[model samples]
Target chain A: MPDVCKAPAAADALLEEERFQALSSGEAKIVEAAASRIFPTTDTPGAAEAGVVHYIDRTLKEIYPKQIASYREGCAALERNAKETFGRQFTELAPDQQDKILSAFEKGTASGLADASEFFALLRKHTMEGMFCEPMYGGNRGLVGWRLVGFPGQQFGYEDPYINRVVDLEPIAHEMPFSQQEALDGRKS
Target chain B: MAARADVVLVGIGAVGGILASELTAAGLKVVGLERGESPPYSDYALKDAVHAIVRHALHDSARHEPIARRDKEGENTRRRPVSSPTNQVGGALNRWTGQSNRFAPGDFKVFTQEIASGLAERAGASLEGYNVADWPIGYDDLEPYYTKYEYEMGITGADGENPFAGPRSKRFPMPPLRDTAKFVLFRDACRNLGYHPYRTPNGILSQRYKPPMPYAQGIPERPGCVYCGHCNNYGCHVHAKASTLYTHVPAALDSGNLDLRTRCKVFRINTSPDGKVTGVSYFDPAGTVQEQRASVVILGGYLYENVRLLLLSRSEASVHASGLGNTHGLVGQHIMAHEDVRVSGIFDDQIINGFIGPGSVGGRIDDFNSNNFDHTKLGFIRGATIGTSGSGTPIERYNIVPRGMPRWGADYKKYLTRYYTRSFDLNMQPETLPHKDNYVDLHPTECDAWGIPLPRVTFSLHENEQRMHRFLAGEGEKIMQATGAAKVWSAFSKRGSRWAGGTRMGTDPSNSVVNDKCQVHGIDNLFVMGASVFPTMAGYPPTATVAALTYRAADFIRSQNALFH
Candidate 1:
């Protein structure tokens, strides 16, 4: 079990996976920017720290191959919308500017994108899943999401019945004792 | 392999597992057919909320087997995913919330006690298209079987806690689970509001215990529940939950009289011209269509699947021309679904750890359940069982913030970070009345992976359900307010849960599919067990009652000499 309550090294950075499974480098940058805007870093870790982009990438490869075309089309159209509106690529925009475009896509107000609302919904859901799900699934890097909301991941039952109180303890991931690198490296092929 | 057995059961899940064990234990040759693979326990490992909640790893994914759904009878339907039916060995029981409860005494006689008791008139409930009817049997008839199933499956609850529950022949195998501080808060609040709150009966063992009496043979001692915050939608890593997968399935196999076949999808209930069920034809593991010869065939799949198989097996050459046991065109009607209505109260401080226990190991009040309370002018004949609930894992609790909070970004994250454990929810499973139009039929367009038409569920909430939802949600809010919460918001799901019926059992054959003996009316050797034969669904988890009914049916199937002829 590891206590993730300690301050992390940093929260914001474009993900540097060994290689993107489904997304290109540019598409990964845009998706990561959108996810960061969806769960931006205020004072705590956000989707960036949680490696939500990698989650999206992995999910698109394994579970949801059908969604890859939607992601590509949505990302490309989103870039066009960014250039037409903000005069810059989506990843180069300010946080508020990125928020504006993502917000339009969420509410179905964005143009040049088919299933903009649908794409945004999946991105949002996958981002949250990345934030909160186990590290074995390629997200929740270092258990930041669990620590952010005081969630203990898979610690077995307590010895006593003191259930109604703050439980701050060292959190443990499933692939603990073995590094998360095993799962990541294993899925690389 | 084309095989022969004394008895054949479809869908080796909660009910089928019971029949498989009980019949084989009686020295009967039983063959059980299952539609999914028997994956090991490691597949149900804890810590991976993504696999359980998101991927629905233990259950069916809607992407492949979408059941077409519509809100009205004639409306154009959309293909919606049916996620409850598990595609694994244990089926839905492997990932249920494990709330074990018996349908109340009045529940079996809904038509007599409520519809004909003038309660409907008093409440001004319009029963135009509603198909509420009395069950062929009563609580007294099934009390012994309920006791039998409880011991066989190992339930945990105090004998005399739920006053509304019917008389019990014996105490539960394990005592009631320990109360949590969250339960205490809900209990005290219910007491303040003049509600009779009790520890919810659960199938999970309170402590390490084995089954007792004539039913305990071959079953091993199970560990007590650890309250590891992963019960619903996740298999028990500790084997604390009393699943038939571990208990009865193993016991059945050990009897050597049982032959269980997995990955065999039964598409049609095969019958001879004389109208006795010869056996069932199914797609075996290697995609080979095969059949088994049986003196008796039992339909023990989920409610909707039972309906689909019956509809799929219909033949003009058989006694049940319209469908199997649908003698009077009543194979898949009178369906009832339970709507989960909830209210969340936000406290200023962390009142409890919101994610560290079994979903059902908490306080609940049955004061408003069934016809326990008056329905006068309430516009609803039945009520809901309201209780305290827990947020499962982190992903499970991600969307449960207060109303009007943005689903993402700063404010949402802030509220969740501090108040994730501060909020307590009181959920109510409202008793949805059976309507004539809320039925299951074969889909006209959508087909499953097997090239068979999917079962189309036509369902919508009626006034009785709507009124019940509002009243129960208000009552839950009142209890939350009684707890001195800073804010409270309530919601009710449009889609329902705990689906029951589609092969309703009654003494009268005109409107029912099965008789009191669970035999299909015209075809004596064809029996239908499980919630599919439920006359009406009470506002409680249906597993306990479904198991009890299976126990009762198993006894009848073994004892009925006419069926063997």
Candidate 2:
């Protein structure tokens, strides 16, 4: 398998553009738009740049199949709000307009939604999970999440002297950070 | 087909694992039924943060057996997606942070102390309805067992440090795990504020195994803790953390007399027509119902399951006409959960390096725990232990920013980068008094996949507990501020957080489920172990105390060999 951490920009783009099995096309568009606004890119690459939507889509399909319906309902509610407020679908809204709708959803003020706050909380939780989770989960691409907050991913052990010291050690750069499959395979072998 | 054994132990985790080892060593043919399968110790090797911590790979998914919760009686209970304690071979021990602390001497006689000082009444905390009871067994009775469990489980600690600790016959078997930078800061801060700071005892081995091991069956040759940051909520990949799976269960298996049947879920304790426990009925992994007959039965499943099993076993035709040991309808009453209050501090001056040590390898001040402090003026009966812990993984740390910081945005990202390593939390585990209203029973509507009624918890914090939590939170803030933190903030749980109880032990059958020896009242052959038997929760982790009680119960059962025969 190719090293996700060391993959080139073109390969990363291709990985991000891969088809999602769980989310509908419209749902995928809303998720990407909402996630970007939730963790907007500034000086650092945010959720969208980290492929959070892809992570949520894959996780919904594979890991948490129970959440698929909630995601669909939540996205449909977001579309309804968009149509009622601006006479357009959520995907066609500008970045600021998307932010306004998402903020309402977060604050539970979005109309015509069943448990809009619950959906907002779920989306926010998934977005954060995608941001901080290991790169192999299709998010945190290129170790950008770890680097954003200076987390050293899965270091075996910090030596004795390092334990009681205040020195900030350099984070390890993994050529191919082991995915869940690789870790399981290694354990089996 | 029915299999027979000298003893049948349900739930091969902390309490059951210890009993399994002890009873089998005494030549008793023991069968341990565990609902969860015993995965190879190497299966604990997946160190993925998302899988281990977020998804809880080692725990039973709530979809299968969701626990229902409601704050008070007459309220509708909702199914919770996850239970506090996981069900597995080693049980919660596999994922526990290894904070091995003994209940202080005062913890055993909480009711006696409250009456003596009249603090319960004077505080005006509505003490009328609370049913806190003193333990029939005192600290002196369990001291030797505590010492044995400490040494047997390879607890790491230094002696003569925790002056507030109850008298121990001997010192810990292993020296305390190496401290992290945060520990050093916390220690200095505590000492500066006129508190006695000491190393917290933990189950993780500090160094590799030395000769003269405590157990009759010696510990397996394994590496000691390497200070891997992924300790709490995550199983140790290296088998360095001394979970029951790595210690007692393996030792029991080595005894050659223990038949540990994993993936066998005990549904009920089968009783004879003459009011004696005949055996237990369990569902095998393939969904086949199997019966195991034994002279003695021990229930050591997590607190909720232990009570739920008894309630589920109730039938009008049963000899007792009530649940076993539920003649007084007190089988699942007086439950208590430790009021956990966390106070975190952000330091701009120094980096605490919060992620570089084992979970419990931090400093602690026990001077405030139990009756160590004066509660007369404080309007509380008991107190809490203030401690610093080190298993703050990056994902958890991402959410801990100074009070006004936004959860997500450029400023939040900046805050995470700056304070992730420089921040630390001083935790307060306060003792919560049991109220008559706080109890566990079966939910009327919700049922698990096995068709067993989900355990319904009815609990709410007493005013006494709330006052105690507020005081402890203030103390935590003081400690954090004394450390020269740039900003400090506190967080507390709501009124009802069900952590333990349901099958409490005491002297009277009128008020308690089990007796002093953890044997079910009026049932000579049946015993219940673990935190379910705790009359009142101490201001500390209950694992070490549970292990000690299991040791005592095992000895008691051995002494009654004639009953088994």
lDDT of each: 0.81, 0.79
- For model 2, the docking class works out as acceptable
Model 1: clashing residue pairs?
none
Going through the candidates in order, their DockQ values are 0.50, 0.40
lDDT of 2 by residue, B1-565 (tens): 6567999999988888888889988999999999876756444555566767666632453456777988888988977766355677788788788888888888899888876567666754556687778899889999999988877777889898999888889878889888787788899899999999989998888888632544655446557888767777777877778777877787789889999898888898988777888899999989899999999999998888889888887767766666888999987888888757889888878777777777678989988888787666577677888999635567666666667777665567677767777788887778877788988888888888888889998888877787888888888899999988999999885633326677889888888889989999988999999898888888898888899999999999999967777
Compute the TM-score of each model's chain A versus the native chain A and list the values: 0.85, 0.78
Candidate closest to the true structure, highest lDDT: 1
Worst 10 residues of 1 chain B by lDDT: B56-65
Off by over 4 Å in 2: A1-16, A79-96, A160-189, B57-61, B122-125, B210-214, B495-498
True contacts kept of 1: 0.66
The CA lDDT at B58 in model 2 is 22
Candidate 2 chain B, run of 10 with poorest lDDT? B210-219
**C-alpha DockQ for predicted model 1:** 0.50
lDDT by residue for model 2 (A100-156), tens: 788788788999886888898889788888887877777777766666665677777
